[model samples]
Target: MSRLLTAAAVAVTLLFSQNALAEKVSVEELQTGLDHPWAVAFLPDNQGMLITERSGSLRYWRQGKGLSQPIIGVPKVWAERQGGLLDVVLAPDFTQSRRVWLTWTEVDNNGRAGAVVGYGTLSDDNARLTRVKTVLRQQPALSSGANLGSRIAFDGDGFVWITFGDNFHAETAQDLSALTGKIVRLNADGSVPQDNPFVNKTGARPEIWALGVRNPQGIALNPWTQEIWESEHGPRGGDEVNIPRKGKNYGWPLATWGLDYSGEKVPGSKGGEVAGTEQPAFWWKVSPAISGMAFYNSARFPQWKNSLFIGALKEKNLIHLSVNGDRVTEKERLLSDRGERIRDVRMGPDGYLYVLTDERNGKLLKVGLAE
Candidate 1:
């Protein structure tokens, strides 16, 4: 009888321990009534913010003023199942140039669609875009509707890194000559950087930096290391967070730790032991559907200094990772009880973590350690 009681107690303790390890955090809503907010960028003066909706509109928000009417001048976009105005980033010289860069699904002739990046100058009221020009456009346009992974990051050296998915063509991920499934580097003016790895390679676009990615949705430059960190969705599991190095290949279709959604082996090599392909610094066996990422350098959350924050769409939480050099040693999940798909994460100018929820009527949330 005592032995039976002891065994039962042990089982209970194990269950409790598992629950404790995966504790769900309480989320306090900050603002509501957003319309599928996809991206958020701080204004030049740090006094306000510009947010992009998936339905092809930009909204402005000033402290205490709340969200303004959807700004005009946004280019027409094909807001299909997963495509729309995806990301918005300010130019490195936004104060002087007022130039903003955007990525969206552009509808072309014959009703075909492709992801495109463009730049435009903001009008005087900062409410409308003007002089828009395409900087980069996807090639060999896809026939199906899926996987338009697009994100933009600017390096301090005046270069832009744009990530593109394989457009549901897994084979394209292994092709170096293809721009899909690659991170491409370009000058601020949309020209291929002369120092890019493929500049001298025949039949390769000079902008190609690194290849073999599936869907890199989250991208940011680490302010301390200046290295670009990206998070991407996996087939069934194996969501990955990686620091992309120049010219290195990150195996996607060629290698993966995930299985297909149909419970079959993924169409790739099984593990990261393969040569010539970069391994992720960290990966989740149960995908979180990581969408946006930002490194915490704010004084408001001193306890979270130098950590990386990721918005998890599938898991509906904010994932915090501690980085030691290039290694991810610790991970914590926040706002798990909220049950809202977090689509975008950014550091506000006021030194707090700003999050955008993914829903028809989303909300702008501020995350800080409870005082």
Candidate 2:
């Protein structure tokens, strides 16, 4: 009787938990009126936020007064599907240096659109960007705008890490000579890091840090381990979370668990178990079109203190994954009722999770943990 009673009690608890999860969670809108807002980062001094729109403008978001006029000085962008001003992040020393980094897409020397990374100083008045200079540009730019992987993160050494997409060119993901479908590491000044794996190689791009990625969108550092983690989109299924190692390749078109949009096999893709390629730390059998991401290491939400949060574009939801060291222990979906594409997920200094929705009338929302 005791064992049976215990099993019944466990079933009741699980049922209640499921009910609670299905309950609608409320979200507070901090700001709105954005046009396909892509990414957001908080100002270190708490002055406001830096937001990027795919149409090639950056805006400042003040807490009380709302979004300031579009800050000028952004470079020209392609402004087409899957292109334009993509990710924006402040320099780690922004409080003092006032420097910011951005990644976007533009026409390259080959007269084709390609990914680029640049930096500029945010003026004191928060009106415009200055001293802007591009440091990285995709060589032999491709004509497609369908897959421009763009995200920024800083590792423990304060070096900048930037991601690039496959540009719908599957072959580029495996070509060491091309900058596409790879991550690059650089100094704060946008120079290549001396320790870069390809610096001494004969023909590989010296800035390339890791290779063989598809449409990576998120990159963040694990506060405890200092290892970099990333998330990416897949065509049909097989979204991924990866801990990209230096000089290694996380297989993309060459190896994937996903099929093409038409349910056909990717031209050159192998199964996820292919040899000579690194596997994802975590991956989904169904495509969520994962976008921005952040690691939670704050006191504000104790229950979720060490989890990973990711925004999903195709599924229009927020994802929380409980991680233990290198393994994902559990998964929870949040804010799915809204059915809006979550473009970005960021943890503010105050411990709140901020999100950007991708829509013509997009929103900046503050998500709170339920008690």
Candidate 3:
């Protein structure tokens, strides 16, 4: 019996030691004094990056040159609670086209607000945006400032994808005609894709690719499979990671593992499962308030290859997820010592990880393997 106990202790000790080694990372502050930075997009050939701030400013940053003043010609945004400039991404053919896309909250004349996507050409000198035009806007806009999922991603086929939250109206998630709480697919020019699942369905918005999501804040294209992975916040608990498929329904208020903040069951949910709705690939029973996500496909950290890194807002940690095929397990939580609200995380072209902290004086951080 003593021999067995000794073996168990050794095994436990080895497990903990391995985890500690795996979590060792070096974080370096790249740029400081950003005002509530929301997202970051790398420029071609490492020329620079485009970053969006929640207060409606877009800044450029490059190594050694430091940060540039806000580029001119950015459209006026609502910039209200949980609103403002959100996501920025380069067009798939940006190198030749100099085209960029942006998403933000905009208000209508009646005080109703919704998320909108626009595109413009980044001037050769990177001084301002030119030839700017709005493309897509969410329908049935509401007054609520919560749950505006505005993440943008491009598929292998160069299709543009956008996520929309329910705007605090949970029931609208299941509504086919409403743009709220859904994923929409479109051509690079903002035209609806005819091959979309709902293009031929009556009373259904033709642009919708998937439905029934809460406040999805993270969306990324898997470097290996090219599949899009999304992460979203649940009401009180039930933060979820999902791979949204064409026309699939991800159970939101209709069926969730989360409860209302008031400790009551979600109003319409029967439970965490429903007959027609798809289950999340992974879920958190206690909400992490997840945000941006990225897949580590670089050799900069060989041990971290193929791992998925997600930012945690409420928990203030970087959640490392070990992914195999479609199955994922929580490998560890990192950067808890920093105690900042992680707004966005992305793998950089230099084979390192870049993180954005949401704060009055936000920071851009570069993370690499500890030597």
The digit string of per-residue lDDT tens for model 1 on 55-156 reads: 888877765566667677778888987788989999999988999899998766766667889988987577788889998898755625477788999998
Give each model's whole-structure lDDT. Answer: 0.80, 0.83, 0.88
lDDT of 3 at 182: 95
Worst 10 residues of 2 by lDDT: 3-12
Residue 50 displacement (Å), model 3: 0.7
Candidate 1 overall lDDT versus native: 0.80
Q: Which candidate is the best by TM-score?
A: 3
Comparing 1 with 2 on lDDT, the higher-scoring candidate is 2
- After superposition, the stretches of candidate 1 with alpha carbons farther than 4 Å from their true spots are 1-30, 268-270
Model 3 clash pairs?
none
Task: Please tell me which predicted candidate would have the highest lDDT against the true structure.
Answer: 3
Residue-level lDDT tens digits of model 2 in 182-273: 88889988888899999999888999999989888999999978998989888789889999899998998888989988999988887877
Better of 1 and 2 by TM-score: 2
